[model samples]
Target: MATLVAIGYPDETTATAASLEARRLAKDLIIQPDAIATIIRDREGKFHVTTTHHPVGAGATWGMFWGFLFGLLFFVPFFGMAVGAGMGALMGKMTKGAINKEFQDQVRDLVKPGTSALFLVIERSTPDKAVEAMSQFGGTVLKSSLSKETEAELQEALHGEKSAAEV
Candidate 1:
């Protein structure tokens, strides 16, 4: 199963740096992500999103996923309660596996004004190396579809604890 991981940074620069590191990791085969994106909310509260060109042939799938997610999280409120409800129902019917209400709420909170986030749909990864390499960027894990045990391992790795193999 693919893991959906969202990490929030204090600003767009940090998030962009982290995304580049993630891409490097993917290139080195330390992690395999189906899709990767960076979302930045400007001071004016507008969202700017950029996605990588990896995972060829699945562009349309990821594009729709990101569009719906961003629209639900950022655009719905401006559209008012009625449209929000309609979009909520549509989202529930259209999405599956991990993209539920809680995740959506967490994402909404993560990318506040002047903040940024890195979103990854990962197929697989070397948790230790990936975490170690990324810890320097100092991001908060906004949400993830990983299992409880796996999430714990990731947290430990982020905290510089023993790696998965060591544990």
Candidate 2:
């Protein structure tokens, strides 16, 4: 199973600091993450995304997943209500019981213009150490777990028949 953890910070600096801390922890083996990324929404509402290169070689797969997820959470709203609603229904169905409406809503609410967010796909972790180290940054954290099967389903939903490697 993999856990998706998103932390929203008031500014890009804090979010970047938190992302660095997460990378440090991963390097120390305090947490094993499949991938990590940061999303910053500038004052003009433009989004800048940065993704790390995973040592485990899952970078491309998770990178694509993050892009699609961010597109739904941030970009869809700009397409007008009809399109947003249709996409919302699709997201709800695709996530189903895993990353449900509430989780999606919380994520949407957390990330606003002039703010930033750190996203991590954790495979294993020493929760206490990881949380303690990151808590000092003081961000709003939202998390959800995906079973292996559900992850495959999500990948399929996002990319049709393409496998993760092909992504």
Candidate 3:
């Protein structure tokens, strides 16, 4: 079983710091995390998301491959390569290149404006110690459970959104 833990903070700075702290702790073997993501709704009403697991150069790689194929199709290898590389780079930037967009959107909708939330998918944790380490940030605990589905249900309940059954 895994636990989905979400913590709400007053601002992005705290949330970001808390996430960094969590990563540092994870490296120390204090907490084992399967995944972690942060969502911040800025003062401008725009949302920003950060995750640790995004490929740094996936765009170029995919672009190169596609470019080669297209070049072969059009009989213009160099031209195809250039176009593919450009298009691939653009696509990568547009996509932020990786991570689950659906999950990101779901989290974006869950938090209020001018606030940030830290979402951690934890495999194992020393509950008391982990809580103590994160206590200084002082966030509203949104959800915690050994089941992702149950956690999702709690989130829906908190937001007064429809449950899966009703949907």
Clashes of each: 0, 0, 0
lDDT (C-alpha, whole model) for all candidates: 0.62, 0.67, 0.53
CA deviation > 4 Å runs, candidate 3: 54-110, 126-128, 146-167
Model 1: lDDT of residue 19: 87
The 10-residue segment of model 1 with minimum total lDDT is: 76-85
lDDT of 1 at 50: 79
- Looking at model 1, residue 70 earns an lDDT score of 68
The lDDT ranking, best first, is 2, 1, 3
Q: List TM-score per model, in order.
A: 0.66, 0.71, 0.52
lDDT per residue for candidate 3 within 66-102, as digits (tens), equals 2332232222243333433444443344235122345
The segments of candidate 2 whose C-alpha lies over 4 angstroms from its true place after superposition are: 54-60, 76-97, 126-129, 152-167
Q: What is the per-residue lDDT of model 2 for residues 1-167, given as tens digits with 9 covering 90 to 100?
A: 55678889998678888888888888887665436778888888888887764322222244455665776677633222222332344456554565656877998898898999988766566434566688999888888777666655544543344345445
Scored against the true structure, residue 27 in model 2 reaches a CA lDDT of 84
